[model samples]
Target: MTRTLEWNVHLDLSEENGTTKAEAVLDTGSEKLMGHGVARCNPQDVDIPTIGDELAASRAMKDVAGQLMRAADREMEAVGAGPTKGPLGKPYAWTDVAG
Candidate 1:
């Protein structure tokens, strides 16, 4: 079986008082997930607006990725796939077990 699905991700960024904040929203039609990040510019470092924006946006994307993974794990467990800790201590499917 083959299937195609499209998920939409929207990112919003803002800066104020040397601090940049970012929010990532993932829309899966059936559900919406949100992630947030913030970046601050130090007085010693050069004040670059783009750099702060990039850093905050990157962090927000990472947050969203983590949220997506957690959602997937929960769905997997609901289907009785069984959840286990992977080598890196991440949630994973456990298919080998005795009933």
Candidate 2:
């Protein structure tokens, strides 16, 4: 059977003291996942707000992706499907992981 679901993501950003911070939120209907990241401007480097925003936002998105993977791993474990194991663990099926 084919299933379809929609999830929404929102981001919040702030800058203070030469540092840019970003927060990513993923709403999965049943729960909310949060990811945070920060970027600091070096004293010798140019102070570009847009660059900092991009860096922080990228990091925050990466964080959210990692959290989503971990949640999926937990769900697989609950369903008697073990998580994948290797240099970088993942939750996808057909991995080396043995259920």
Candidate 3:
């Protein structure tokens, strides 16, 4: 069997008071996942808009990746894959779920 899929990710960035905020959205025809990130510019460091944007965007994308992994884990369990740890066998549960 062979399968092909295309997932689209959209990143949005904004800056306010030396802080850059980013939101990355991953769209899969059947579901949409979102991640958020923030980057703060140190007062002593040079203020570079591009740097902040990059940092925030990267963090947000990572967040989305994490969410995707966890989602996959949950789906795997639903399908009787049995219990398992995170990617690479590390225990992982978002703060909210862990609590």
Local distance difference test values of all predictions, in order = 0.89, 0.90, 0.92
Candidate 1 structure quality by residue, lDDT tens digits, 30-59:
989899999999989999999999999999
**Candidate 3's residue-wise lDDT over 1-99, tens digit each?**
999999999999999999999999999989999999999999999999999999999999999999998898788889989575555655556885858
Worst 10 residues of 2 by lDDT: 83-92
Instruction: Give a tens-digit lDDT track for model 2, residues 1-99.
Output: 999999998999999988999999999899999999899999899899999999999999899999998888798888988554657544357755665
Model 1, residue 32: what's the lDDT? 90
Report the CA-based lDDT of candidate 3 relative to the real structure.
0.92
TM-scores, one per candidate: 0.79, 0.79, 0.80
TM-score winner between candidates 1 and 3: 3
Residue 67 of model 3, lDDT score:
98
- Measured by TM-score, the strongest candidate is 3
On lDDT, the leading prediction is: 3
By summed lDDT, which 10 consecutive residues of candidate 3 come out lowest? Answer: 84-93
- What C-alpha RMSD separates each model from the true structure? 6.1, 4.8, 7.8
Q: In model 1, what lDDT does residue 33 have?
A: 88
Better of 2 and 3 by lDDT: 3
Clashing residue pairs in candidate 2 are none
